[model samples]
Target: MATNLALDPSLIERAVEVSGEPSKKAAVTLALKEFIARREQRRIAELLGQLEWDESFDHKAERSRK
Candidate 1:
């Protein structure tokens, strides 16, 4: 899928410079991939943390019921 959207030229310039990708498309792709990976990592960490909390709660509840 392809979409067209306008962005601030200054931001695009900075991204292109830092990425050294020579093209706006390449810079945006790199940045978008990094952004998605970071979000996925955070999400996985959060889910694991929640699972740990749930297991701890289950153990506590079981002990109290005995």
Candidate 2:
């Protein structure tokens, strides 16, 4: 599969240099994959945190049941 994306040249160059990949394409692919993985992990954590019931909510329910 082939896709065209326009990325900053300086950023791409930095990724290639740090990755030490033989080609720019390889560096870009690796960088993009890592970025996506990190972003997804953060999003999942945020969602999980939001789903958890707060202590205040639990206390309120206990009081109401008394």
Candidate 3:
């Protein structure tokens, strides 16, 4: 998909610097990905203390065994 956008030059410069992305496109992609992840995290936060877990399972031990 091709879209034409008139983005601010300074914003692009700052995004590139902060994100460490090689190009404007990459910086924008990273920004969007992070934004989506943050939104998803918020949704997950809403589920906190509402989910059931196995009391006997040690997640850290399983990962170490793997």
Candidate 4:
């Protein structure tokens, strides 16, 4: 999709320099992907210890059957 936004030129330049991306679009795409992955990791981290475990479930038995 073709979209336009007023972004900080200095920040974009810094991103390109630090990321070593050849173009502004590449830098922005990499930044967006990293941002999304970081956010998803944080979300998954928040779920830690929130799930119930089945104490009676035998993993060895299941593995042996197969």
Write down the lDDT of every candidate, Cα atoms only: 0.89, 0.88, 0.96, 0.98
Residue range 1-66, candidate 4, lDDT tens digits: 999989999999999999999999999999999999999999999999998999999999999895
> Highest TM-score, which number?
4
* Alpha-carbon runs more than 4 Å astray in model 4: 57-66
TM-score of 1: 0.67
Candidate 2: the clashing residue pairs are: none
> What TM-score, computed on C-alpha atoms, does each candidate reach?
0.67, 0.60, 0.69, 0.81
Ranking by lDDT: 4, 3, 1, 2
* Candidate 1 clash pair list: none
> Candidate 3, residues 1-66: lDDT per residue as tens digits?
898999999999999999999999999999999999999999999999999999999989988894
- The residue-by-residue lDDT of candidate 1 on 1-66, one tens digit each, is 798888999999999999999899999999999999999999888887466344445666778894
Candidate 1 regions exceeding 4 Å error are 52-66
Query: Which whole-number lDDT from 0 to 100 does residue 63 have in model 2?
Result: 86
